[model samples]
Target: MAVNTVGYTSQITAGFRAVELAHNKKPIIVDHLAQHLAGAALHTALADYQQLQQAQGPGRSLRVPARNRIMDDFVLEALQLLQQQQQQQLDGDGVVQVVHIGCGMDTKPWRLQPLLHVHWFEIDQPAVMQLKQQLLQQAGAATATAPEPGGADLGSTTAGSSTASLAQTAAASDGRSCVAPAAADHEQQQHQQGVRFPLLPQRYSAVPADLAMVPLAACLQAAGFQQQRPTVWVAEALLYYLPLDVACELLRSMRALSGAGSCLAATCIDAELQQAHLRLPSQHYFSTNKVAWHFSMDELAAAIGAAGWRMQGQPQTAAQLARERYGRETYVALYGGAECCFTAVPG
Candidate 1:
């Protein structure tokens, strides 16, 4: 296989860093550095083999492409806005039911490491989940390896998070937190010292299933869905990959399995830009190879309504929508960062 599990695993993390960096995860170097490390690790066998067989050796290590950061920032801005818009609904219950449809190796879940009380579940292709599970293990192991929590904050989240396995949502979402002061500080120093990765967490299980074809509800049940109850499904950078029909079906199935007050959040582009706006030459964007169901924003929204969903209001203020998310400079750079979302409930 041209790409093995690690290679693909690196790609997955690259994808996450892309979203994070595009939105300006500064040092900026960190994302690029992480990308290259993951890419190298993923393709080590191929790269090493090529060096022996073909004198050319492997290509330059894959790091965060410089151009992507600036451009992706706008795109991420648009996406983060859409996400924040949908995430707003997770309130009052003292529980955050969360399911990340295509979650890569993002530490948000771990960083916001809910106390044991918080239940969390991540869904992705099986291989990808394998990587996630490893990362989560690394984190937990490191927690044990590192100095124990010094104050209320340290032991608080891990001990406090309420369980709601299906949604991956935690009980008390007071805010996002993870990584120790020493660890974060170590990472910062490592960057200054030009070291590779500061430290990574143990991987949690990111379930594997191609939801594009098979309905997820069934697989979910087997994976502890019934134990968790209502789910807050969040799909970031995933819908674009599925055919519209398939996308609609997933949402419908999620609703069918939902008990009450379940929420599903996703980000999609306005199909109108397919030929025009989305035609950017950037290799990082989710183009045809990655996205099977290209669509226009209007058509997507209409499709959602057709599927019985009502678009919820966003946290849009006086500023133009995209600008508010990533600022005017980035918004313009990223083609107004066109994206939208819906938070529909069963009536």
Candidate 2:
């Protein structure tokens, strides 16, 4: 079945990463899996994002690779700390966990290669997770089934051709072709057309859930989450879409599930931007999904703090990080001057 693309924010973000990868001279965060996972949706999403960027002027849009970089760096740093603490305490190579809440087509587990002694859990809406699974399976990223005796290796050659065939069929149906029209050789299209399979690591979990309806703790537990293990909780581009109380409750639940050495790295929105009348480009897309911004930076801090999380430092806005790290200046008004990123640890 063809995946529904309406209000599919995950595909759009994947497109944004792909755009960054293709256009930027030096990308802030390199998401190699972005384009492949995006597949047929890539061109449309790329065009939409490019239009938004042009209208917004200068820097980058909401899902800038630079913003992704901040969260990516935090995850790496958190992992390093978890590993060091494990070594010091003689914890016998305990599983270091990283959970991505609202993990929409994120390629972190694949992109952040060499994640030794670690387990990853990605949670998102059921349909969204389904879409991700389909894309990953199509891209040849999912674990392949074992072949029967005397049969071909289904995971490699056979699977590759089948996927390419599917890609070709889908593109043809849509009046588009994965093969670049300008390219003269059909074989080049065959090689470059389908999404390349990234190095599939040993430990990764995808949990399909509707955070509004299901209990986050229950979902995590079902996915083999260990409460006593060191974890890095990532809530990038989440939080604000929920009601204030619901957002706080979510934070509290994460706190309840957290063990020693667990920390949170999340992107935040300022209360100012959450004002109903504010017309940010991304807000229009979010509004269509029947979700609205609720938590401001201060409100988010308070929520996490009340949930037993303490901020590691002052929350830094995307604009700040972009300027400091990439030397690219952005209009504060673009993102409403919201320092939309921060990290926190258990109090």
Highest TM-score, which number? 2
Q: Write the per-residue lDDT of candidate 1 for residues 1-347, one digit (tens) a residue.
A: 14334336446545435433433434232353333324344344334323433442322221222222332343233334433544576753223245566655443343332222223456666555555445434433221112223411221122112223323432222233333343355345435654333332211223456565546775454333442344556665566556777777777776677655555656565444454444654452334443443565566677776665665664121123324432422211222344444345544
Candidate 1 Cα deviation (angstroms), residue 263: 1.5
lDDT (Cα) of model 1? 0.43
Instruction: Show model 2 residue runs off by greater than 4 Å.
Output: 1-7, 39-45, 48-63, 143-195, 199-201, 280-283, 288-290, 330-339
Model 2 clash tally? 2
Per-residue lDDT of candidate 2, residues 1-347 (tens digit): 45443325667678778887786666667877788666666786666656656777645534456678778888988898887888788535555788899888787876674465666777777667666777777676642222223432211211122223423422334221111122223223333544255433235566666777768786676555668888899998888777778888888899889988899999877676666325555445445244556668887776677778899889888878777866765434333445478889889
Instruction: After superposing candidate 1 on the true structure, give the runs of residues whose Cα lies further than 4 Å from its correct spot.
Output: 1-96, 113-116, 132-205, 212-214, 276-290, 314-337
Please give the lDDT score at residue 117 for candidate 2.
60
Top-scoring candidate (lDDT): 2
